[model samples]
Every structure is written in structure tokens, then in C-alpha cells.
Target: MKRSDESTYSWLHRLNPDPYSLAVNAALLELVPPGLRLLHYTRTTVPAEHLGAFAFYHRKIGPFHLDGIPEPMQREMMFVIWRIIELGGRVPCAPMGLLMRELAETTQRLKTAGLPFQSLTDRTPAQWKAELSRTWVKRTHAFPNPQTFRTYVSPLDRACKILWFTYDTSPWWQREVWDLTMDPRIPRRTQEPSGQKAIHWHTMEPAWLRHGGMYFVKSMMESSQLAWSTAHGAKNALVQFARFAMARGLTSPRLVQDDRQLRGLMMEFLTELRSTPNYGIRNRDKPRSPASIGQITSTVRAFYAFMHDYGDEAAAALDDDRWDGLSPEYLRFWRPGDIGSSKKEHFDESYLYSDADLAKIKAAAPLLGLPRAEGGFGDPQAMRILLLMMTTGRRINEICMLDARPLTLLEDNLAKLRYQQTKIHDAPDTIFVDQEVIELIQEQQAWLHAHLATIGADADPPYLFVSRHNNLRGQNPYLTHVFRTQLTKLVDRAHLTDAAGDPLDLGKTHRFRHTKATSLFNAGVPLHVVQRYMGHTTPEMTMHYAQTLDSTAKTEFLKYKKITSTATESAVDAEDLYDLMLLDTRTDRVLPNGWCTLPPAKTCEKGNACLTCDLFATDERFLDIHKSELVSLDSLIDQRQEIHRERTGEPMSENHVWLTLRRREQQALSTIVKNLETGGSKPAAALPAPATQAREQAGMLGGQGVRTGHRP
Candidate 1:
């Protein structure tokens, strides 16, 4: 082959003539640009500096000593070098370096054993390692260290598997293995916890059923009907169904064509799922939980529903007519009662970290990123990510995927942080953060800049917490599992425990979000405000995280005593009233400045007239609020009177219906404020006569007299 003039290997007028060298040159010509190859080199020597300039250079591997090695070994080395270059196209740089080193070592070992180099297809990793070890001992009269030998062989084995395996990029519906990571339509957030990315339809028993399932999953993805995580879960549940189908000899979709048989099959599957040992690694020997079984049954039902709805399209996609057997009745394979309810009777607060535990976690958080030599976890980025989570209450992925410059200072000098709302599409992506959070983020930015500089990476990184290894451009964010692993180490090192005194499961990094939400809500933050701050699409989602703190609840409830419109304390016992009204659980009874005093069973006849109503009550806790409202009301009344008088060309009537109601409300507020100012006293002048009190009670109860019993 003619070499280009700019090619680094152009100086080689005559090649080694060996097939390996010729093959290496040919492969390099295609794989690498001509300008990148060694242009000036002597036959006897290949310089290390020249090799260092190549894209596939291994930092640890030095110059080739061609004169010292035999011809055969040199040819073998060249062949392996070409293979390394090919593998590097698929793997990242850091891992590629290790793989190259291992392959180079293996080449040397093979040269020593006087054995021809063989591909993984001809010899398995174990077989090659065993042969190498036996040959080394026979020739040297000693054994190689077991650990060192395993290390030498491990990377080669991994590299071989990667090189030999071809990733399927065909139309998703046509492939048995759906590699979600390669699918651009799928968001990275939905492919979480790292490492597990592919959905293996081939693992499901019965080929025909597998194709039908694949069609369902593909349609779901194409239409954005399900997230990658949810789709993966559905795939898992279908695998369970496939297993049951195989066991019952229902190998084809046609086997259960009848709706009755399908229903029976589902019932049998549910029974088997309830009784069978879990196939999952975590709880392998235990029976699945009701929630787990329910999820499986629901997924299977959904799969059937999809098949029934898209029977024609699925049949065409799979090129199989069997999918036509699916009927609308198959959609109702399981009834609502058959599905187990997974709702908890009470919310579990065990996930929320206590103030004391939080302080402990904060104190020990630095150890997460400390060097291993310093008895730390040696993952500083994880420590920063943890601190960000603690302060900003961001989801782990949001923090991980933060831009290098995420903070923008507002007019008030406070900073607003911008993060990707990965879970909720098009949700609010920016949140107001305090100075502490701003400083933490800035510190992280500075650390990342310095780290990239040290590693000779891209100066302007895309992510705040860039992946530490295998990412030369600083393009990808740190993996969520990496941060969790470091956090788990910190928990163990600090002896962190949950409320139950069990070792804390920092694996649920989301507990930080729950802790922050509950703290803010308990500190009197409004539900709508908290929802916006947490980037929740609905107040319901915010409430899920904001469990009421018992201490806060008690403190707030006992902060005031209920006083009536006459400024006298209510006759009902406070504790009895609290229970009778179900104030703790009833949201409607809650008001801005106070709570409604109406009996739980009664309906108020007058609306927005709480101030003059006998059943309306408040206390000193709302003194300032009432004062503000009274001033505003007085101003409003004055403005309205002026407007009416100007329009009618005379003073507005004091007996005007609106004026009368306003004056009554003003009198009631004035009495309440004066009483509260005097520490819950009844003003002698404000106290009403027995007939007036009876009339007020009659008006409040819609003409019904006060009952002769304990007030609710």
C-alpha cells in the first residue's frame, strides 16, 4: 500500500513483509488519519516520543524495542496494537489505557511461552490464563502470583468481550436486545443507577411472545407513553409472565387465544408469583411482597391492553399473525379487587433525617471526598454533591447534571440556581437559593475547574460534577451510583443511624429532599410556595414530601386560645374542641389568621362574614394580623364612602347595607383586638346582654337556639 506524504509512517520505504505488520498497516490506514501515523522512523528503532503523539497512545507503555524481541513476537505485538486501536473506538480512554496495558502484558507472556497469539473466539480467557500460567511455571520453575495474574488477564477478557460483541442498532422493534443507552429518544435521567441499560427480550421464554412484547415496548417508546425506567419495569414484569407461560406450555400467543383461558392464565400466574421465591438478587430466597406482585399483575394487564389496542400494527411489525389473537376482553384479565393496594396506612418518617443526624452527616460529609490515604472515601465531587443535596434539596440527577456555571445572582444579591428538571418534563428549572447554597456551588465550580486543569481535560466543562474517569472532554456528569456509593461509605464511617437506630440507608439520597420539604413546611412555608420551590408539578407532589413535624404541630396548636367575637374565651374545652372539629386532619377548617369554630357536622349559612359570626374565633397569635386588617378595612370603608357621596352629591348613608355590614365587622374586629391586647380578657362594655347573645347564636346557627350540651 502507498503511504500518504503526510503520514507519520511514510518514512518506512520497505515494510516488515510479515503478514501481521502488513495487516496492522492496512488497518491503521483505514482506522486513523494519515497525518497521525509515524512518518519518520528508522527500521532498527521506534521512538517513544513519536508514539506519544498518536491518538491511541498508552501513557504507561514505552517505545518498542524491536531489536530485542524476536521477529515472531514483534509481529504478534503489532497485531495486538491494531486490535487495541479498534477497541478504543468503542471504549473510553481511561478504560482503554488499562485494556491496552493488559493486552501488552499478555502479548509478552505469550512470547515467553513460545505460543501463537489466539483470539478470544479460539481460546477462552480462563483457558488462555491457565495455559500461560502452566507454561510460565514449567519454563521458570516458579508460580506467578495468583492475584497479579488474574489482574493481568481480567482486562484482556473484558476487552475481548467488548470487541467481539456487536451492539444492535437496527429498528428497536426488530431487535431482541433494546440498548436504551444508544437510543437518543430516551432521556438519560430515565436510564438511572448506571450499568444496567439494556432490556433483554431474548431472556424471555418463547420467541413469538418475546416479539409481541418487544412491539408493545417499542410503541410505548415511540409514542412517549412511558419513561425508559417504567418501560424497563414493564419488560421485567412481562418476563415473569413469559416464565409462567413457558411453565404451562403456553409457548405461542395462540395458545391462550380465548379470553377465558387468558384470564385463567393470569390468575395462575398471580398465584405462582405470590408463592414463588423471588428471582431478584436482593431477596432471592423470599416470597415477593404484595406490592411487588401487584406491580407485576398491573404491568401484565397493561401489556395485554397495548396488544389488544394495537393488534394490527403489532402484527405487521412482528410479521406474525398470532398477535391478532389478542382480544379486547384480554384487557380485563385482572379486576380492581385482584390488584393489591400498596398504599401505606400511615406515612413513614423513618426516611427523614433528624436535625441531630443531619448535623452529624454534615460533619462527616467531607470524608466522602477525602483521599483514601487519608482514611477517606476519595470522592470529593460526591461530597460536594451531597452538600448541595442537603442545602438545595435537589434531586441527585439534577445536582449531577448541573452546568459548570449554574448560579445567577438576582437583584437582591441572592442567587438563583438553574438545573435540569429531568423527572418532570418542562417543569420549572430554576430555584432561588441562599448564600450558603451559592457558595457551595461556586466552590464546586472552582474545584471542577482545577480538577480538569490537573487532568488536562477541557477547560470549559459542561457538567458541574464531571465524571472523574474515562471522560477526557468533561462532557458527562458524575454517575448517580458513584455518589451513592461514596455516601454509603460516609454513613458507615460516621456510624450514622436512622430513627430506629439502624444503620442509615443513604442509598435513598432522596431522603434529603423529604427532609428539606418537611422542614420548610413545618416552618410555616405555604403549600403553593413549597411546591414551586421543589419544582413539583402539583401541590399533591409537594405534600408527599412535606410530612408534618409533630413538635411543630404541637407548638403551633398550643400557641393561642380561641376567643369569641365578644372577646371572651370560648366555653368549649380546647382539647375537646380540637378533637371534635377534627382540626388536625380537616383542611377546610383552617383559615389564614385563625380556624373556623363551626361544628364539623354544621354548614355556615353566611360566607366571608367570619368577623361578625358568633362561631368565628381567634387569639393573640393573630393580633398583628387583625391590626393590619382593621387598618386596611378602615381605609377601604373611607374610600368607598367618598366614592358614593361624590357620585350621589350627598353624604353616603350610614344605614347603607354595605356600610352596615362593614361597621358591624369593624366593631367585632375592634372588640377582639382590644381583648387580645389585654391578654385574652372580656371588655366590660363589649360584653353583650343575654338576649343579644341568644340572637347572635340564633343568627350563627340559622335561627336554631344554642343546644343544651357541651359545645363542639
Candidate 2:
């Protein structure tokens, strides 16, 4: 082959065929018995390297993956397909749909008719064969000839029955039979049922099934691009709504078609939900919390809205003309006041870890990986998760879902954690983590490698925290329940509790996040710094996590109160004094006699000669401070006066300018002392400088405008 052809062939070869793909080919081929010819199928690919690759058959819904179908299921489905093709029976247009509907109706009839119901279990082989033939001919009208009936229909019916029996009483088996029989041409990735299995449409009342409960789930999951969990929840919620309707004798969708009727139903459901006890026996006596009630109601409201938008198909199928009057606007106006805030505030100190509690946790962390013989039944994964939680302040899911590949260790032991944000899908790609967190992750890496080795080299664990259990191998550690259980044990073993003597509530792993964020905040970490550390997109979220401590609040309040009370005066209130204190020129420039009331913009002409100025006003608050400064000034003046006497050889006061300055300061200090002795009743009151005494003396002596600039 040419190089171009080879490249095309390689691309074609990469298109790994699944059972459904094989089954679709088998159905399409009009060849002879067993139709093994389809098994020799090859893909056709484009030659261009830039264009990537394409295949001959992509399923209707979306393109299938290389290993979309599990090997075991693929083999079983292929065998069924081959056998059908060998029987020379033409494939039906909607093969799976017809087969499942026929099987469902047949099963329903068999139960209704009350045939020798135990005949299959008790009867002879011939009798069983006869019964199978009778049921196939009676129920399924697809069989073309008698030969095909015996060869094709009889065996297909038997296989369906056997599958139903083998799975015991699972209603999903009916769908399973359909799945096996059909080509499953949907070109999408395999969607597994997450959380709980969806309630089968057969179990629900006819109204729900007809009015788009199951159809909605299938459409949203397959076509509308809803996630498996979301689709599953909607399906479950609709099922519960159906059950509620059935109990109230409101079997059909039309009964609650209007907004008013639907709202009434919604109110009734919510009221009953509020009174209903929790599911688990431990909390069985306790009524469902407001948050839980809100979720249930919201789910139902969502269902109603969905039905309103797409219920046209369902309404058209309705036998009654009232559907024309039915507004697809059910529960649009129904308001259930904010359910998220119904519980206690998120900022509870009881949930946070104290220094002592943290120390206990730190000690207990290592005990998780100890052998069971040494009284440790905990997984190392749990310990690592807790460590990450305490240090990173990230949500448990965010840490759990962290990709092993994105744990990049840079120089200086700094590391970056790259992850797809689980809560808000469009959040940042990476957040910087501390070295200690990187170390814990490194330990997890070692554990993961060892785990994969034990599980065999073919096994892949995508996440940082992976389960090593036989059943949940290669999956995330069961943090939802298992991790919490382990943490609770650690808490109990460590005897960790609060100042209130209450045992630590490991109930919320989120407490670790709050504790970490609050700790950073309490340590005076900047809001932006805490935000980045906690992987919060906004500082507000980090602030929310940083719950205020009552002790911190009280201490800060007392400090503020003391400042205010000391500054308050009978003439000037605390607010006025506070404003005055904020003025730029209200500093230590004032003389010991009084504080300077100089405007900040003005330059003082008498810079160092503040003692002679009248712009000064003294407050008792700074009296001691001023007295200390005065003592230092007097000591400096004596030293300068001695130097003046040695240099000039004359009385220092009469000859030196420095002695004159010291005398002026001494005079101001004496006036302050005398005023303080007389005005001892007032505390922290501003007093004028005694430059006024000199001004009074000058006025009496000269009787001219005493050019002293003294306000006093």
C-alpha cells in the first residue's frame, strides 16, 4: 500500500468497533446465515493528517468511543445479533422499541391472565416449548414465517424470559433485554446511571409515563446534553411526584395542568415533606430539615417547568381536549422562601478546629494507615484527604477530583494544583498550593502507584484520591460516607472537642475549609491572599468562610471604646475630638504648655520656638508625654549653656541666644505647671500656653499692641 493509504488504514484501524456498532452492521447486511461477514468490517478514513479521522458508521445520537461498550456485554449482544441474522429474519425499523414494547405488553398480559404461572418452573420441556411458542405468536406479530417463528421468535422470546428471570425482580431487566436486542445507534458516549438507579417507567402510573417523565429523562440525557446525575435526579423527582399523585387519586397530568392546580399540589407536597421524618433510623424521629424540604420542592418545581416547556408532545398525546387550555406554566410563580439560609449560619465556631483540636487531628492522621492489628481500620487515603482539607481549605470534591498529572512541583518546593472546577465548571485552571500540601500529594502519588500495581498495570486511577476496594477500584475514595466515617473515628479516638465540651462535628468536611480560611484570616492574612489559597474566585467568598470570632470582636471593641472615652470632653464630644485628632498638624509640634492648632498648609515662622507661640493648646492626654519631652529639653539647655559659658567667657543667659531660647521654654513649662495645679478637676482638657502671662505683663508695662502673637 502507498504511504497515504497506509495512514488512512491506520486511522481506520483506530476506529474500534463496539457491540452496538457490530450489531448495526449485522442488521444492515442482507447476507446468508450467521452473517459473520459483518464481523470482517473495516473503517474508511480520510487521508489528511490535519483533518483527524472519521468512520463509516457513527451512531445516531453521537460518535461512540473505542471502548464504549464493555467487553462482556458486547460479546453477549453480538451473539444475540449473529443468531438473529442467521435465522434469516429481516430486522425491524425500530428494532429495540418494538421488541421492548412487545415484551412489556406480553409480561403484563401474562400476569393479568394468570396462566399456569409456575408452569415454566414445573412443566416438562415440551410443555415449556409449547408455552413459549404460544406467547411469541400471540404477543409479538413480527414473526414472518412459521420456520422463522420456530427458529427466530421462539428463541428470542426464551432469551428475554431467561434474562428477566436471571436478574430476579429488577425492573431494569426489561430495558436490558431491549438493550441487548437493539443496535443502540446513538452516537454518544456511554452514560451510566449515577447515584441511585432511575425508577423504571413501568412502576410509575400511566399518566407519568405518558406525560413525559421517562421520555424527558431520556431526551435530556441523550439529546438535550444534561449530565447523568442531573437527568437521574429529575427522573427520581418525577417518580416521587407520580407516587404522590397516585395516592391522591390524581392519576393524570391533566388533573394538575393549570398553574393554580400545580401550585396547590406543590404546597401540599412541601408541607407533608416538612413534617416527614428523615429516612435513616438514626434520625428517623427528626422531621426533614427545611433545606431538604426545599431541595425536594425545587426538584419538583424544575420538573413542572421542564414539562411546561416540552409538554406539548405529551399534551398532544392526551385523549382530552383540555390540554389545549393547559398552560405549560406550572409552578412558575410558586415561591418557596430562601431554603439555603433556612439552616443555621455557615459561620459556626463549633465546626471549626481549635489549636488543641488541630494538634489531636494531626497526631491521629498517621493512625489511619496503621494495620488493623494495631487498632487502625482506616485507609491512608482518608488521612491524606483530611490533611489536604486542613491545609488547602478546598472543598473535599475539588481535592478528590484533582488530576494526578497536574500536580506540578516547581523550584523552591512551590507546587501548582491544576483541576477542572467541579462546582463552577468555568473556574480557573490552576491554584498555587503550599509545599506541605504538595508533600501529602506526593505521599498519595506513592500510594496510588502501589495501588495500581496491585490492581494490575491495566488499571488506571485518574484522581489523586482513589479507592482500592475490589468493587470501587480505580474510583474516587468514598468521601461522601466512608471518609466521614473514618474521620469521625479519628475524632473519637483523639477525643477532640470544643470549649463547650461538645465532641467535634465531623458531620461537615467543609468545616475544615472554614477552619483553614478563618485561621488565615485570624492570623491577619490579606483577603486576596486567603482567597487565592482557598481557591475562591472572589474575596467575598473567602470572607464568608472567615467567620468572625466573638473574642476578637470584643477585644477590638474595647480598644476602640477606650480611645473614644479618653478623647471625649465636656465641651467637645468624642466625634469632634476624633475629627480634630485626624488633622495633620495635631502632632508633637505643640509646646509642653499647649498643643499647636496650626493649619497643615501653613509654614510655621517660629519653627523651633514653639514654647513662645500662642497657637498651642495642651490636652491632659499628652501631659505626661509632654513632661518627658520638657525634662529632655531642660537637660539639653544646661549642656548648651555650659558650652556657651566656656566659649564666650560671660554669663551664659546674657551672652548666648541658646540660653534665651531655654529660658523661654522654661517659662512656658512653669506656666503649664501652675495651670495644671489650679485646673486639676478636668481630665484631658486642652489648655492655652502661659505666653498670655508675658502678653499681660507687656500690655501693662508698655500700653502698646504687645506684638506677642499670643491668643491666650
Candidate 3:
């Protein structure tokens, strides 16, 4: 063989003179790029090279023996090395030779023993597990440390998956099953290794329907109309519809173009959805919940609507003209009333943690980060994230995706925290946090810095709460599943129980949001303010989180007596008023400054004239407002009188419509102030009659003809 200094592989000719070794070396060199061949074959110590393209450093290779290894094992080791180099992966070289030798020897032995194992990629997960057990049992010395074996096998598993799934070259939408992890559009912060990330489109029948479904889902994701999880759900719902359609031989969209046929088909699908068990492995035998049925129907309806609205685009994108078969009937295939309401009449308050329960949980919070040997789950990040959720009422993803410098300091130990509102688009993301929260954040930052330092990372990580392991430069945030697991352990350790004495379920971290919102609402925080704090786009969403406590409602209602427009206390008892108005369940009766005493069945004759109406009532809580209104009324009357004097030689007549109305309003306000100031204990006879009543009596007697009675 000839040697050339220009080629990095020239030194490979010096390793072994055999043709097989040279051929294997040449193939390995071809697999690796010239830029990555930074060292020669004779060099045992690998030099550190910073690969700017990959944004990572190729660290020094560990010591390993290459002599006396079989040629096939040698080729496998070289392939592993070149593969890691090609993919820009970081796998230490020392274990590469040993692991490759073990695998090669195992394969030969398995083949000789007629086990029929060709390669790792060909083995099922169960078969692979059995092979690993057999390998460990046969050669315990080769893998003394289980962790070392895991470390060596991890990269090989990834390589096999990439080969088997074609994850590198194939587009996710082109495959029958789309893995969210392979989709670049998905936000990395929300990605997880576990859970239902794979969306199976192969289950949908008929090639056209399947293709159209894929196009619809991809378009929805691309347009940001739905999240990845929501789109996955939509796909699942479409699969159900497809199954029904296929079974009935209605495979083509054109077959259901008629309104009556489509309606009938949808009705049948709804019936099947209601009767059939859930599609997944977990709840395969259980009947679908009403909420699930509603969601399925709604999603299917949305899919058809999308098809109808974007038929031309779908036809162009899918390269098929059949998409034009969708007619106007597809847009209205399911009526609004066809989908039953999924909302329950009674809310389950068990999800909320009361003050007592919170105290118990807080007392047990210290057990979260403790080591397993110390009788606690070793997860400090979970504890910190939990505390943040408890204080800020942020969504779990928001808390998990917090930036390294999320806090902005204001004056006087107050700070504002910014979080990523992952669920809602264009929602407010900042909330004022107190010193306690600030301190917790600072502590977390310090811990993260120290952790990064220990891992030889020089810069700050992108996220505040980072994953514990396999996080290159702490790029990935802590997984929500880990937090949930830690919380479950904490609940078990604390022996916490719900009101019903069952084991408390802290699995739903969102309950923290509900608990905080309810606490604020019951503490008299305004709904709009809570809405902003909770990062909700609407008050209705915030209200869903706030469950008003009965005690708080009754206490707030009975805080003061309800006085009538005549400055006399109402004849109805406070408790009776509470029941008659149903203040606990109704919000329409609540006024800005007081409560309206009008019965629900009766309509108000005086619209904005509440001050002069007999049905109006107020308490000391609105005393300041009444006084301010009185001052404004007096100023208005003086201004009008001055204008009248300017226009006429004499002051305006006392019976003038405007003057009479102002005086009546003044009398009502003054009477209310006096009643509120005197503790509202005076009898009705103690206060004089309102000016409106006197004017009404005068009008009835043909004096000035001023009409002061309620409108008929």
C-alpha cells in the first residue's frame, strides 16, 4: 500500500499489512468526514477538538487496547467510532472496543447456539432484554458495572433506532407513525421521553382518508392552530371516525357528500364512540366518558370543517383531486347541540388543597430533596418547582420552562417573575412575586450554577430548572413526570389524605393553580386581578380555577346591614336576604358599591336611578363612595344654579325638572350617609322621607306637576 501525508487515512496502512484490515480501514475512513480525522491510527491518545458546527467539543479519547481483537470485532469498533464522529455524538472510546468485542462474540455464540439473533436492530425489545440477561449471566466480568454497560449500550440503541425508524432522513409526516420528538416544530422545553408522543396514522382506513388526515394535522400544526398534543388528540379522534367509516364501506369522502348521509354517518359514529371502549391500552375495556365523547365529536367536526374550508389547499398539498369531494355539508356535519355539554353541574373541590392540607404538605416538603437513604426522594428540583407553583400559581410547564434570569427586581424587596406561557398564545407572562419567591429563585440559581460548574460547564444554562441527567449543557428543562413522581413520593411519605380519608393525589400539579386562585378569590381579590396573575386570557378561565368558599361568602355578605333608599334597614333578615338573593350562587345581584334588593322575578323600572329607587340598598362598605357622590351632586347643583342665574334674573325654580332631580338625589345620598354613619340601627321613622316621595305626593296634588314615581 502507498502512503501520502495529505490523507489522514494514510497512516492506517501501517497498522496491519493484511488486505482485509486495509479494506475495513478504508471503509471506516470513508464513513467519517476528513475534517473529523484529527488524529492518526497509531495515536492511542485522542486530542480535544472543538467542533463548531456541532456546538460541542470532541473530548480526549480514553485508553483502550486494540491488539489481539478479532478482525470482525475490530471492524465493529471502527464503525462505532466513525458513526459517533459522523453523528457528532460523545461516547468515550475506552468502552467502545470492549462493548463491540462483547457484542461480536455474543452474536457468534448466539448464532452457533441456534438462537437466531442476527443483530441488535432485528431483536424485539423483549428479545433484546433476554439477550442482555444472557450476556450478563455468561460474562459477568466483562460488565462488572451495570451502569458502564448501560452507558455503552445507550448510543448503540439510539443508532439502531435511527436506522430502524429512519428518523434522520425521513420526514415525520411521511411516516405512518409520527413521533413528536422527530418534529422540529415542537418546542424542546415541552418534549418528554415518555407518554403518548407517537401519533399512529396507519390505523385510519382508506389511503385517501389517511393522506387527508395527515395533511390536515400537519397543516394545523404548521399554522399553530393547535398544539402538538391537541393535534395528536385530533388525529386519534379522526382514527375513530375512520374506523367507523371503513367498517361501513364509506371509504371515500364523495360517498358522504350528501347532508342526510353525512348526518346519518355522524350519528352512527357518535353512537359507536359512546358504546365502544377507549382506544388505548390503559382503559381499553372502560366505556368512554361523556367528556371524551364530546371531545371526539368536536375534533371530528373540526377536521371536517378544516377539510371543507381548505379543500383547494389540501388538494394541492396532497397532490390528489379527491379532496374536492368535500362539500358544504362537511362544514356543518355536526351541529352545536349535537355535542353534549361536558361540564359537570357540581365541581369536584377535592383537587384543591385547603390551608390545613397545605400546611401538612409544606411540613412534608423537606422530604422531597432528601436522599433515598435519608428516607426521601432525591429530587431538589421538584421541591423548588413545587414551591414556585404553590406561590405563583403558574402552569407546570411555565414553571419548568422558566429562564435562568426570570426575576426582575423592583423596589422594596419586590420582584416580577417572567415565565413561558406554553398553553395560551399571546397571554400575559409576568406576575409580581414577593420576597419569599425571590429568595427561592435565587437559591435555585445558585444551585444550578454549582451544578453546572461540577459538570465542567462554564456558562449558565438556558432554563432555571434543568433535567438531572443526560442534559448536555443543561439544555433540557426538568421533566414534569419527574416532578410528579417526586410529589407522589412526598404524599406517600407524609401519609396525606383527602377530605374523604383516601390517599391524597398530588399527581395533578395543576391543582396548585386552582388552590392558589381559589385562595385569592376567597380572600376578596378581584376577579380581573386574579385573571392576570394566573396568566388567563379571560375571566371565565380564571373563574374556572376559583371555587368560592361558602364561609367567605356568608361572612362578606353579613359584614354590614342592608339599608334601603330611605336610610332605613331592610325588613328582611340578613340570613333571609342571603337565601332570597342566592348570593352564594349568583353574581348578577352584586352591584359595584352594594347589592340590588330587587327580586329576581321583577324587572327594574328605574335603570340608573338606583339611588332614588326603593329597591336600592347599601352598607357601610360603600360609605366613602356615597360621600363622594354627595359632594359631586352638591357641586353640580351649584354649577347649574349659577348658570341659571346667568341666564335669568332669578335663581332656577325649585320645581324645575333638573333641579328637582338633583335635590332628590342629594336627599337620598345624605340619608344614606347619615344611616351608615349612625351604625344603621335607627328605625325608619327616625329619618325623614326622601325628597322624591314628597315630590310625588305634591305632583299627585296638582302642585308643579313633577313626576317622581317609578315608570309604569
Which digits, one per residue and each the tens of the lDDT, describe model 2 over residues 1-712?
1123222222222221111233333333343233232222223221222111122233441121212223332333334433333222222213322233333444445667885332122332234445445667775554335664343233334333322222223222123211211222322222221122223344456554434554455555556455444554565556656766777887555566455666666667666666666654466668877665656667666655666666666456443333344474563535646234455355444556777777867877888887778888648888888887787777766676676665877777798887645443344557687788778888988888887666443255556676453222354333456678887887788677766677877767887877777777766677788777666687666667554543333322222211111122224343443445336455433233333455567767875555465555454433454455456666766666677679888646544575666677667755654454455444342222213333233323122211222333
User: Clashing residue pairs, candidate 3?
Assistant: none
lDDT of 3 by residue, 135-238 (tens): 76687645347776665454444434333332123445656656543344443333333223567666568777788888888878777777766777788888
lDDT of 1 by residue, 360-396 (tens): 8899888887899999888888888888899988899
In model 2, pairs of residues that clash are 34-86, 61-187, 62-187, 62-188, 63-187, 594-617, 594-618, 595-617, 595-618
Work out candidate 3's RMSD over C-alphas.
13.6
Global lDDT of each candidate: 0.63, 0.50, 0.65
Instruction: State each model's C-alpha RMSD to the native.
Output: 12.9, 17.8, 13.6
Model 1, CA-based lDDT: 0.63
TM-score of candidate 1 to 2 decimals: 0.64
* Residue-level lDDT for 590 in candidate 2: 26
Residue pairs in steric clash, candidate 1? 8-37, 8-38, 8-39, 9-38, 9-39, 369-379, 369-380
Q: Residue 456 error for model 3, in Å?
A: 2.4
- Superposed model 2: Cα runs more than 4 Å off: 1-211, 217-240, 257-266, 273-285, 313-325, 328-347, 373-375, 471-479, 523-543, 546-712
Using lDDT as the measure, the top candidate is 3
lDDT of 2 at 564: 12
Query: What is the lDDT ranking, best to worst?
Result: 3, 1, 2
Off by over 4 Å in 3: 1-99, 102-156, 163-170, 183-196, 203-206, 255-259, 280-284, 546-576, 579-712
TM-score of 2: 0.52
